[model samples]
Target: MSARSIALDHLGGAEAAASLVSGQLDDLLIDTDLPRPGTIYRAIADRPVKGQGGMFVRTPDGPAFLRQVKGLAPGQPILVQVTGYAEPGKALPVTARLLFKSRYAIVTPEAPGLNLSRGIKDEDLRDSLLEIAHDALGGQEIGLILRSACADADPDAVAEDIRAMHDLARAVLADAAGQGPEKLVEGDGPHTLAWRDWVEPADVACRPGSFATLGVLDQVEALRRAEVALPGGGSCYIEPTRALVAVDVNTGGDTSPAAGLKANLAMARDLPRQLRLRGLGGQITLDLAPMPKKDRRAFETALRAAFRADPVETALAGWSPLGHFELQRKRDRLPLTDVM
Candidate 1:
């Protein structure tokens, strides 16, 4: 079993918690007062932005811009899902691609398929899960994707989750023709997000004040600072600005010939975890320590490997002309400074 342990407790809200791995702060999540991601809303198209090929929809929260669509009237109602956190004073990001996601299954309303997670490669196991999915779906046109968590999950539990998501999808889809804008399904809170996304086997502590008892709160305080301590006397500073997040790597007190390479590699490996904890995203520019061109491949490999395990979607935009690396990440949550 993994050494990861989850601490679920209240902090400034009804839903807030931290996740620890091997007794160290791995991730922190706090449900904010704003509308949560994945919330399904029956929205009315407000106006179409010229030349952008999109229209603004009056969501339950506020006006949301929907992309890649046409033939939208100002009063037409359509279903949209909250895509991610929006900048302050900006319209909430939303999309019409509605998804019903749970722990073991994800129900795609319009897409139709019975797909198993590729992580489960065993043919017999795949066949068994496929049978369960077929039985649960009962040949519905709605799409169902068995999550990776179902690989070793109990058959009955998986089936139940599938049926539940399927039913929810049907119910929500049925309400698309409603009269006015309304929230059909509220999104998952921080604690529910932890339970749903953190699928690795781990001990869970949900008693009151567990964050304080388990040192999660103390660890959280460190997030206020931009400097992240690295192994072997190295460190990196993450500072956010209006344009993008700037990360500068420093090999403190290490002057070896390979010092820059080592420090840069360490930063690349730990950068994803740090970003997740800090709840920072958008454009990221990394000013790595001075290293030879040949060493950048190693750093790039390490960076890619690090983010492969992160649940959030990130795009590595490659190195800039000035040797700085750039990345674009999803705004899944508010910045840690804003939350704390």
Candidate 2:
């Protein structure tokens, strides 16, 4: 397995980067004041959308669209969680269902159940985690999910994490009935996110200037450009426009018959990390280097496997009639330019 590590330090406020010992930045998070996902807000309902069945709600950030809600009068209070980042100058996307996510546990108010991450397959470990969950939940009706990182973690530490998340969930739920528009919970910043999501075992450097020491600063600086160098001599340019994000694959100087296939496969596997680092999303069109139709299935399989491990929610919309591949990704992270 590739050795993973996280380097965290302040650039403007807070910045963190994850790398796989390949001298390339796998993920980058910069602290921005924008309302982040997983933040709960006690919002006041505004007018409903004409035909979308979603109601607009007033929030500290701006007007956030609350989905799947009905029968809302003007200026009614409701608790909602930010689902993801919204497009520029658009309504912030929100959902009625709230989930409190943390490093080792996730508290679900609506979904009542004790669950373990699917990656935790060891029966003995599962039993131990179940015991810990039962103790922390204290028979609460709310749900608790033990994340994969809890598999081999210290029992006490895991219990503490579970209790912390559970308490936060309870507190947020209690404030749901409060009056007017209010910010209930602030979202995690880059340093917090590094600890919560970069769960792989690795060295951590959190002191001042750790980013420079770990070469994370250099890797992050490269993300400002659109061109991404792929394995072998291949390259891809990731350009974001108002309408969509476009990628162009190039096979460089390789002249072999399988060169296109090789380059395209390399690009597919690395595209998720590139996008994650750069924080680009929404409609993506990939103009791949010319490859055989017979190899399309293999290329698709590679892309699917690559994205399966990515934390971002992306829909591989498949190939267009013009032979370009398409994807729709969530705007979970702000664009690097916006945050940098």
Candidate 3:
């Protein structure tokens, strides 16, 4: 995917914002004033609470829990990165992996094989990055993820920057070790970093009520609607339950056999786009208008082709005995409605 447009709309609350990328509602950022997930913080290690899998840490934001730690003791300063937000009535999940995120790369000292860049497709560029990271780390195991921005950047510049980032991460780690309790080192939230890497700054144009003008607000509202009209004459009813997302395709008022087939084909093409745009995940059951058994294979082929551009991993499990097409997509994050 090429660089896309991004717009940040202030939600009238402190540090709260809504981000739109490529005309899609990509992320919702809520500011709790506490370090959001993906942030690295320093805290004073405390004794593990009884029955809890993680140890307690005294942070500047408040007392937080480090879910994954080793060789830690009370009063010892520890470095932890927030991996997950505190669920309702739950403690935050943190880890010892210190991450340094830039617009084009993510550097970490713990994971050496992890590469997160989606933009570097050229083999030479990839090799160059690996060599640079290897040299910068001085044989120390580290992880580097190059973002889309690095796809066209100068290799030398990227190498220098990665080296600088490595040094910075090391400094931070040293500081966390030396600094005493209650000190917090904040890092960028996941949403902020996502927008930074995916959306080009030059393409951004901020305006009042931009979200509404760009149809972001309307698109979100439409996701909650039960039915969506197709291009030709059919309609699709989407019902998301606890078990899975059920989608029923109907011919509406068009009763002709040809029209029904056409509508089914249109629904087949549009369903995957809808799923991606809405960020719907998990098991999906597409109930199309019943057709001849011979035509099912052709319809399945078309359906698979429609999902060729989807970034999320999806698998077509073939049609069910009841004639519904079954599919499952990996869930990377919560649905749009739940996040909103």
Candidate 4:
């Protein structure tokens, strides 16, 4: 979580309140109600009495949350915009600095990077940065949510946000180097929201104050056909992992001659596309039971031919000493299965 403040010169409490409600303020600005002779103000709503600081408000659509402070002394007008980075080193270092119209809250990391290649270690780098940023903000308002908080988030979406934040930070830092703090990064937040709106899947249904689906209908329709149709009586159990995803196939009651090795090979061949649609990568092992001896060679031949069409880099090998025909699919980002 993060907070920032800006002095809106000549804008009275009513005007500020309107701006907050109308989404004009960089974030929801909380009025401190400082009395001044020429500054006429009125209470538009029964705001919290004690803390002049506004409660945390999630920045429209981004993964970020924000708080606002108001009521600077007359003639001492200033604009402040504070942003909190929650993803640690994953937070784009350069983009986070540009989240303000008056001034950025602070450039901070979300967390220490977890070195996957090395032994697992946890370091609180973002915590240290937030502490520094809080001191700069005069200890008035601060909020924090650990990166672990985003555990269940869609990995693809998070990757995109991180990319965007990094890009914005880079642009701002470049300009600031030449112009100092004279210019402010503006409207980046709205653009982030627009990007999310455009990229979100069509099948997702968003409701107020509730979890919504990710994709739109149009985006999901194609996926519906991507599923590998199980034979008359087989069922599949999916197991996902960062390295690779494994799907278990049980040839249930549908032991028809039609469900022979040739038919099974055909189905397995068609599976690569569905796997791709799910953005599956790394190794995929399909455990299939033994078929009638007569069809064995034919099944092997067909399976090889089918795999030839897959866009993903794949290898189909024989049922192992363990009776599993292993297929390895290369990984890029998080698999689409995890995203969906």
Please give, for residues 1-340, the per-residue lDDT of candidate 1 as tens digits: 5698898998776578778888899988887788999998999999998998899899768899899877779999999999998887778888888899999999987678788888998999999999999999887677889998998799999999999999998899889999989999999998888889888888899999999988988788888899999998999999999889999999999999999999999998899889999988999999999999999889999999999988889999999999999999999889988876
TM-score of each: 0.98, 0.96, 0.64, 0.33
Please give the ranking of all candidate structures by TM-score, highest first, separated by commas.
1, 2, 3, 4
Mind sharing the TM-score for model 2?
Answer: 0.96
Residue 145's lDDT within candidate 3 is 73
Query: Comparing candidate 1 with candidate 2, which one achieves the higher TM-score?
Result: 1
Worst ten in a row by lDDT for model 3: 10-19
Taken over the whole model, the C-alpha lDDT of each candidate is 0.90, 0.87, 0.68, 0.37
Best-performing candidate as measured by TM-score: 1
RMSD of 3: 5.7
**Candidate 3: C-alpha lDDT:** 0.68
Error of 2 at 222 (Å): 1.4
Q: Residues 1-340, candidate 4: write the lDDT tens digits.
A: 1122122221122211101111112111112222111111111111222463432222212222123434422222122233222222221101121231111121223232221211112345444433433343344322222232123334444344344444444454444323212223333332232222222122211243111122222333444333344645564555665555666665667666656454466556556545644555567777554576567667677777866855346776566677666776554223433333
Alpha-carbon error at 229 in model 1, in Å? Answer: 1.0
Model 2 residue 88 distance off true place after TM-score fit, in angstroms = 1.3
Q: In candidate 2, what are the lDDT values of residues 1-340, reduced to their tens digit?
A: 3477777778766555555455556777877677878888999999888878889999877899987777778888888999878887789999988889998999888898889999999999999899988987787778888999997789999999999998998888888888878999988877788889888877777788878877877777888998888888989999999999999999998989999999999999999988888898999999999999999999999999999999999999999999999999998988888777
